[model samples]
Target: MSKKLRNHDEVVFEQLLNPEMAKAYLDVALEEYEQDGDLGFFLEALRNVVEARSGMTSLAEKTGLNRQNLYRVLSPEGNPELRTISLILHHLGYRLSVQPIQS
Candidate 1:
């Protein structure tokens, strides 16, 4: 029997398939954002988690956004509105939360 090798990205995507793993991945991104003050990390994490779940097309449908626009808004170069981001997170079985930073 022969074993096939999966790409790095493929493995990461698989990790996101598990809810706990996906949340952990996003938590790391959130921590990075807190330290770096970069919203792009959060956006990218959301995009990856969404893709791992139902994909952009289904997410677009749930969010009432155009498929192409969803892709654009989720891209690293794209900036999405808070409402849009909240909606995506809600649909993906997650929600935005506020926390105090540790000193």
Candidate 2:
């Protein structure tokens, strides 16, 4: 669980509400996958949002990916390359998934 979700529900509620909080928390989960470029959490999070708001065609249009290639990369089983990931991040208005070093 994200510290943001677990410890900051009040803040989260005041700022993000439920669904947005879930996505933010999942962004935290993405950190665990980043060391190896594992796509599990990233894929899962994208799947939920994609299924909710639109499909690959719409997302691809926004990201400037070809629809067929976007479908392959965004598919739950696919591994999106860093460039594709960057484009998706821009299209989604999400940050490039980054982590902070522990002090």
* Tens digits of per-residue lDDT for model 2, 1-103: 6554455434443443345665676566576666766777667666555544556778877877788877677666788788787777566556574568676
Clashing pairs in 1: none
By TM-score, the best candidate is 1
After superposing all C-alphas onto the true structure, candidate 2 shows an RMSD in angstroms of 8.3
TM-score computed on alpha carbons, candidate 2: 0.60
RMSD of each: 1.3, 8.3
Backbone clash count, each prediction separately: 0, 0
> After superposing candidate 2, which stretches have Cα over 4 Å from the reference?
1-19, 32-37
The sequence of per-residue lDDT tens digits that candidate 1 reaches over residues 1-103 is 9989899889999999999999899999888878898878877988999988899988888878899988888887878898888898899888989888677
Assess each prediction's global lDDT (C-alpha) against the native.
0.88, 0.64
Model 2 clash pairs? none
> TM-score of each candidate?
0.90, 0.60
Worst 10 residues of 2 by lDDT: 9-18
